[model samples]
Target chain A: MTEDTKKLLYVMTNGPENPDKTYAPIYTAALSAAMEIDTSMYFLMHAAELLKKGVAETVALKKGGSLKQFINMALENGVKFYVCEESLRDLCNIEASDVIEGVRVVGTSTLADLALDADSVISF
Target chain B: MRTECSREWDTEGELMAIINGCEIPDELHYYLEGSQMTWIRLDGENATIGLTDPAQTRAGRILHVRIKAAGTSREKGKPVATIESGKWAGPVHFPVAGTITRVNEQLELRPVLINDDPYGEGWIAQIKVTNQAEVAGLLKADQARTRFNEIIARDNVKCIRCQK
Candidate 1:
């Protein structure tokens, strides 16, 4: 790891369309963790629906595996997982404890802080 | 000429095969110029990469897989992931220099996917290559199978997944 390594901020906005869009950001963030780069993934809008218990485990990409599987990979490897607090409440009507173990529900300011700190940001 | 190949699609919809005695699918690209056993699929600057059937079979059934983090550029022919099997342990190297976009995180919990489905669900990484032309320089499909047959024969290697 170097000071120059790019920290990634991945914004996931889609959810359960095919229930498959969620996989990309989680996979990307997990890969960033594997590369030992600093990384964070923020779930926004309908994407917050994925954090509801039992949803992620059931969604698997054709060959990429399940969302829970991907999230576990991200969590085990130290990628920060977050759900938009506003989105969680306004969209899913859920609280932080409603999310799976690794996710934290935070406000937009946290999202901004993470995005600005990242050397690179991508959205899915 | 396309080598004769027979694949048994796993119950979960992935493909695997043992051509002659070693497993080498007829679809993956081969970086065989210097005789590396990596497989890559180049579409523009993005590529999906993994080990050839022969390489995976030689490694035995992978018991674990650990890939490097994404968002980092790797030089061509550098180690990207490490796999441990009951009989052998080895590194999965990339065939081109690029920033790794993703890894098959499925392997962390089910490392056996490498042995069970190396080409599909078992893929090592997806790289955003710096040079797509470098990947174009590698062999594809039939050419890869032909080279794989020669290598398997030369080394007298025999590979079988041995699923119960």
Candidate 2:
């Protein structure tokens, strides 16, 4: 929360369909937050599906852990979760009520603002 | 014993409790509330801090550790170090508010030392306590053993030390 605190934005484009790619963003985001960095994950395109209720719960990585576990960890570590409003409505067919409790339904403009403000922008 | 450090401790000491193969040395003070599994060993006004044995086991093999520089002042519940292991990543919160006096720099090159000797070489930091009362507020070894016993059963954790 300090002026010098670094901001990191993770742009997630993959979803439950790509279970392997889903965990890294959340895992690293949680770690970054633990490091006292201002960390956020912006779920866009297929990645927005991960914010849908019951989606992360059903997706388990090949390595024998559930996506829900990492998501919860990230949430507990203060990693901000954001779901693209456009992607959720148009591409994912997810209503605001269908999204998980912790995620914020934000617009593309918010993502642009976050990216511009961030010290690093990583895409998954 | 898994390592020289553990072997040196009096394994049969009356203060030590072996719960599910994890040693809880009652001689040290513990911060077992929530998932903050840290211990404080007081030496005058300076307190030595480290992750508990069960903590290292749960985290699996520690891969990286980044501790705050010495002389950094921190409040209670703030992290003195951030640890990343094969299975987990999180902050190692200090029980007492103080200024950092020392950090285990050896952990940078040999992070697995935490898994090998959690009570010894795995120690994270030392702090010159700002509040001596906070140091006393930490759980004693006996209380920590009772609590950790329940936690180990609930979490189904079996303490396993890595051969280093």
Q: Choose the strongest candidate by lDDT.
A: 2
Docking class of 1: incorrect
DockQ of each: 0.02, 0.49
Q: Candidate 1, clashing residue pairs?
A: A31-B70, A34-B68, A34-B69, A35-B68, A35-B69, A35-B70
Quote the positional error of residue A85 for candidate 1 in Å: 67
| Tens digit per residue, CA lDDT, model 1, A31-118 | 6665557788999998888888888877767743467756765676568888899998987787777788878888989988988888
Error of 2 at A37 (Å): 0.6
Ten contiguous residues with the weakest lDDT in model 2 chain B: B4-13
Candidate 2 docking: what grade?
Answer: medium
Residue range B1-164, candidate 1, lDDT tens digits: 32211222122432333245555566667776443477887777688988766667665566777788898687776668866553333456678888889988888987767666767777889999886657667887788777766665555555555352
Q: Considering every candidate listed, which one attains the maximal DockQ?
A: 2
TM-scores, all models, native as reference: 0.48, 0.87
- Interface RMSD of candidate 2? 1.2
